[model samples]
Target: MSAKIAVKGLKKGFITDQGLLQVVNGISFDVADGEFVAFVGPSGCGKTTLMNIIAGFDPPDEGTVKVDGASRSGPSAKGILISQHGSVFPWLTVQQNLMFGLNGHAPSNKEQLADHYADLVGLKGFEMSYPHELSGGMLKRAELARALVVKPEILYMDEPFSALDALLSLRMRKEFLRILAEERHTVVLITHDVEEAIHLADRIFVLSARPAHIKATFAVPFEHPRRLSSPEAQGLKESILRELGV
Candidate 1:
């Protein structure tokens, strides 16, 4: 697998009322094409900062980020970032939200594509519903469908299930896995949930406290429909938790 995204010696900081507030520190990693990678770290540990730099939403004060061997300057259509709060337009119906990014396509084509993804994400009957009318889980499904409808080459998810209750989060994880199996988009996820990282990532990177950098990395070798209760999964989860100092 070749590298789809690469980061080298990344360093970022912000100006604060007190002084300079350093966030990411000398972080580096590569996410392979079609691979699902997750970053786990303490709160305020700069995981999202690192992700934002990689996604071209912000520039690193030092080091570099490259996508497909080219330097990333700004947000690219090839990638999309989804957050825990979701990004659907509250005033727009599910169908309109999904079709928002299909401006380059013909009107009929956009409708067909939006409808296809709306159904795929289990929002078939809610295409006409607005975000305010949907539940937390339904809103998440709508966000996923909206992102997928655009067929981005990479999906950057920042604690995408953090807003849901435990059971809903678990179900969404399973549903997300099923969707990924079919769409096969390269993914980079950031989460404080160790179990979520274990369940969804092909590889996990654990970061240190503030001014974060990779402290450890783990490979999850379990097959799909993984059993979190299995010895192997539990052991890996334990190792990750230990690294996180949990």
Candidate 2:
């Protein structure tokens, strides 16, 4: 079943020279099953930190992170988190990395899973390719497939495409949209790129600078394969900018 994530009164903090910095201040939101939602905010706004809590890498100082209608303490099989930087092992080939999380599964099943994902991410012939040998986009694709192979009900991504070469970034975005079109998977994406968020998200949540709070939530009701330069797109961007006080 597709997973729906509901986060409430979430808060995170850390001690600094400035005293306790409460990054994500009691932020709350719900992600509908199979919906693509973008979390946009300025730097040091606790966007990533909030994502980490939902992904179960770290616990929230307060509030509840529930998945599929149940309480969650740690990372749940219901979802997979894809961080901004490439997390693929340098020592592993594209195929091998896809096998990283499938350690306990049978060998044959793992091979089947890898082969299926290789084809899914358009990396069929590059299974033996090492991370270092592939281009930036290719490496991200491998990681994407690896995350998808686990068949997570929810996918949490943290600026996964930010550092890619421009052309590669577009290709990856198209691939991302393609994957969504194939099978509906609940996805929460943390990004600062307004245009990217407009193109990929069904809804966008804007967070305030520090002690982050939900500034605004925009429902992106555009059809898929939306043109980036469309009037509607421009309007959405304008509204988001205004919300962030940019």
Candidate 3:
């Protein structure tokens, strides 16, 4: 449980007509290697903002973010951040889109890379399919494959399954969790779904309403494909809800 990723006094701001407005209010935390940790809170709670800073997509006006003891200034070889929205290039076919990210990393073995993730995400036969032709859930799976093919040390997921329907989302969640569990990739999830955070995360960091800071941290004890009806899972969710005053 060494600190693979650490955030210290992180602060971010945006310029507005009202002048500079702060978002992330010097929040701090640490993530252990091979740990699946999730950030949960209501909207405008700075969960995504803090995640962006950690991903190197957004810079903090004040504070520090380090991965493996090095300060991160941009997307690094140590990690990959999957944005909340689309990461796929619509003009490219599924294989092409997937291949685009893995290019030059493995050279002429690109097809093998494509097929590997295709199978990993259950998109084996649709490599030739275009993004526009695929459903929302499939697109997400493709993104997941793209990020994973690089074999990142840390995976930053910003509500990756929120776009799908209940059943599909559940399926995707189980599969995604299984892949990470199997791969042993350290992950930081930014989500609003308490049940989801509880189900897949080894540790959950709950944030305050806004100008966010850690309100509490909970450890989930259930195994993968954790049951929604499991007493432990249900009890954890209820505890979070009660704490959050939701």
Candidate 4:
């Protein structure tokens, strides 16, 4: 299949007190249609900056980002970004939150769509719950539900589960995969967790520090519902860490 998302010679930088601070530098990659890809690197390596460019939230200083063969100009309704700190509304109930983006739709249609997505993300009974009332895992699920409700072509996840505790993170990974498989959602995840990348991605991109570039790319051969404790998975994790120079 052709690339659903293609980036070439992508470079980005920011102005700081120390002058221009380069983040991404001469990076290139392609995410196939319906594929789950992950970027893994040390902190400050610009993985999130690259993601933002691909998601059309930030324009690169050089090169290009294309989605479905078109150069990305800005954020499109076809894609959604789920930040590390989820964008859930504290005051909105789960039901109302789900309905937040469905403006202009008939009430009955919105209600049905909201209910369907709520159940899809395992939030069926918590529709009345507020964001503060839900556990960390549930809050992530609600955010996922909110994004999926709009039928995005791609999900830009910047460490969607990184804020949770270890146990909760594990559980959320499983839940994320389960929901993603059912929906066949395409994703590009930015994560510093090598284990998380190895466990979840179809392919992994290891990036260099500071002026980030693709140091290595590994195609994970294992299927989903991955056994993280298995020797192969552990071995891959070590390999990725080595690439990151950790």
Please give the RMSD to the true structure for each candidate, in Å. Answer: 1.0, 1.8, 1.5, 1.3
- Candidate 3: the clashing residue pairs are none
Candidate 1, run of 10 with poorest lDDT? 83-92
Cα RMSD, model 1: 1.0
State the displacement of the C-alpha of residue 218, model 1, in Å, after optimal TM-score superposition.
0.3
Kindly list the per-residue Cα lDDT of model 1 for residues 29-139, writing each as its tens digit.
Answer: 999999999999998899889888988999999999888998988988899999756788988999999999887899999989999999998889988998999999999
Question: Which candidate, 3 or 4, would have the higher TM-score against the true structure?
Answer: 4
> Distance from true position, residue 14, model 4, in Å?
0.9
For residue 111, model 3's alpha carbon misses the true position, in angstroms, by: 0.7
Tens digits of lDDT, candidate 4, 1-246: 679998899888999999999998899889989999999988878877888888898899999988889887899887999987789899999988898988789999988898898998888899989999998889999998999898889999998988988898888788888888788878999999998898889999998988998999999999877999999999898898888887
Best by lDDT: 1
What lDDT tens digits, residue by residue, belong to model 2 across residues 197-238?
A: 998999999989998889999999899898989998999999
Task: Report every candidate's CA lDDT.
Answer: 0.92, 0.88, 0.86, 0.89
Q: How does candidate 1 fare on TM-score?
A: 0.98
Query: What would the TM-score be for candidate 3 when compared with the true structure?
Result: 0.95
Off by over 4 Å in 3: 103-108
Model 2 weakest 10-residue run by lDDT:
1-10
